[model samples]
Target: MIEAAFRVLKVLEESDTPISGEEISKQLDISRSAVWKHVQELRSYGYEIASSRAEGYDLIASPDRLLPYEIEKHLKTWHIGRYFDYHDSVPSTIGVAKELCRNKNPSELHGMVVIAEEQSGGVGRLGRAWYSPRGGIWTTIILRPAIPVDHVFMVTMAASIAVARTIRKFCGAGALIKWPNDIYIGNEKIAGVLQEISAEAETVNYCLLSIGIDANISEEQLPSGVKTPITTLFRACGAPVDRARFLAQLLREFETRYREIESGEYHTIAREWKSLSLTLDKRVKITTPRKSFEGEAIDIDEYGALIVRKDNGKVERVFSGDCTPA
Candidate 1:
């Protein structure tokens, strides 16, 4: 019904004058009664539909809802958001992506996105809870990359670079990427990425790349016990940003980097990721599932693994772990 109303409104928008019920029915191949029902539904959703005896219906303005049409109007990416599924509220977009991947064909679902205005059960890295308020950007990208399983970490690195670059471009602040997936502005975390992949023994089938940004969320909205310093765009700039425009820019940047990953030009992305990384060249402590080690963060290798030189003059390459400044 919502789609039908939008179709009617779009027709009215393209027309030079108002459209009648009969004309709308003929154009949309629907019954006149159906058109009336849809028009009423549109009104209920806060669409100002100017109705007159002579002029059947006209759309004056739309509600402040984050509809897909509004998002597509501003979305400029080629592939990142070509197909979008949105919800006013959801438990988690990553969960939605997982459910979709189970029944739906992954190869047919290229560059699809799942977004939620508010997340009730968002999970972060290491199974940590993510406090996702209504004002933040919470979304996940679904991709089927034909890369080796060992190189899957590059996807997280690519997304981290994209988010950091986008924040720096818009906020004009010095944004840096902490090792693995955190984005920071002067020691306060502003964004993070979570990557989940399903694979066979040697090939990857699909990857869910989830990125959450503290766009307009307030400090008061945050939960207690968050020890790390955190900041939002509103707090840093003293105003709310246009969320739709920022999201569009972020998707565009991500699509560009994703293409680089697909083309096996990972070293190029690795170089840029290293440059924006705050962990490189710092004395750091890394904790894996087994043990912890402290060393000088020397560099990240071509495959996006962190290389650390220990005080004992031995070097270690860590593929996945929790890293912190020592």
Candidate 2:
């Protein structure tokens, strides 16, 4: 309902003259009272609106919140982000999305996105707590793709490609896909992707694609106990990038790649991932739970494993591990 109110305000913002309540009601297909109520709601959200008996409502000033209307104005994808849920703060977007899936039918919930402005209990890969404060992009996309469990890792690859492509196109940042699920800009972490799946008998029931990016975040906005140095798109470009438009670009890229995955075009996705890789052809160390080894990351296998050839001429296919420059 608030999103609809924002749409009404947008109509007023785009107009040079004051619009009448009956006209707003006609355009929005609502009653005149409803338009008045929406104007009140807009006032509650810090939007300054002027009204007159003859001249309708006029948008005076707008707030800097990531309202659904902002994203909707820029979003152009077919399915991705078609049903978006926005929050000022949440424990985690994944948690909200999971609960939503649990309560609703999965088939009807495809491509629904849960996004938060701030996360109090955000999580990362390997059970690490992510520091998601204000001024970052924290989002989780709910997908009910028909891909099998073995091919679920490809979703992560698709998301990585989306983030890297968006950073390059929007912020002009030379972002690279660090092996597995990390985005880097010259050795500093800028973004990351996490996938949570529900499977039964090697078939996926649903997939949660969570993405985090430090788009406009500053150093002080970061929570304490951050393990490594981090950089934001704002810092990388010396100015803030438009987060809403960037997100639309990312969702478009992701939807395109996702449709490819559904069509069994795994080879194409893998080729694009390799093109954006930062770990391939580099001497790297892999740390699994059982052991750790150093080798050159030669390539990634068909199943998304990092193929490393060790110094002793032994090649290993690592399905899950922490990678770093050796």
Candidate 3:
């Protein structure tokens, strides 16, 4: 069903006029009833297929779901998203990616993306629960980076820039990256990134970069007692967004930034990140495992550490922490 259905879909997609069931069966080497069954299966997945005894079948419209076929149709990158795994619901995309890395070859899994429509056990930074209801983007990309382990944090930095730029281009929102790896629209949070790595002392085995976005989810879908101000693209744009297209743009942007890092262009990422900084020059609370303090986020270093100037006039570099703007 998987291979033949995709083959049938590809033929229909490439055709300008409606394709007859008999013609599709002859081209695909399957029975006419098989073609009809696959078309029904595709329609159940939200593909609008028009059927008539005279005109045969025509592709009317594709759904907004993040199906592999939908993403692959619009994706233009070489390796990023070249191999995709989509699920209607899962505990976590990060969890699924970790299992794939453990069982399969890490190198082969590079540039692969795992997506879930809903996550029941999604976890964000510091093991906090991430609310991943339907109508959002919950995905994790597997990478076998050639860069040093010290520079691995830059992957998240690259992802941050990608998401920010994609939102600006696709949704027309003036999105900015909050220090570390969070996307914000003005003062409200719209997206966040969580990165996990399996690394040795100096080499990285594989990296799982997870990204979550509240694309079409409404404010009412979010649970109460949330700590920070949050927002969705639907609210910001006054309508639902096409999630599949946005994801393809993000993967392309990320692949470009990732290539830069692999080629040792740290300054390029640093400069772009600073220009899009939402926390710079603002008073923020930085809480690390050791201590907490208030400071102004002046800048970020080449390796993506937040350079903070404390109230005591002392400067410190924080590699990882929870940054909250006051």
Candidate number with greatest lDDT: 3
TM per prediction:
0.88, 0.93, 0.96
Misplaced by over 4 Å in model 1 are: 8-66
Error of 1 at 177 (Å): 0.8
Query: Which window of ten consecutive residues has the lowest lDDT sum in model 1?
Result: 62-71
| lDDT accuracy of residue 143 in candidate 3 | 98
**Ranking of all candidate structures by their TM-score, best first:** 3, 2, 1
The lDDT values for all models are: 0.86, 0.89, 0.92
Model 2 scores a C-alpha lDDT of: 0.89
Better candidate number, 1 or 3, judged by TM-score: 3
Q: Could you tell me the lDDT of residue 142 within candidate 2?
A: 95
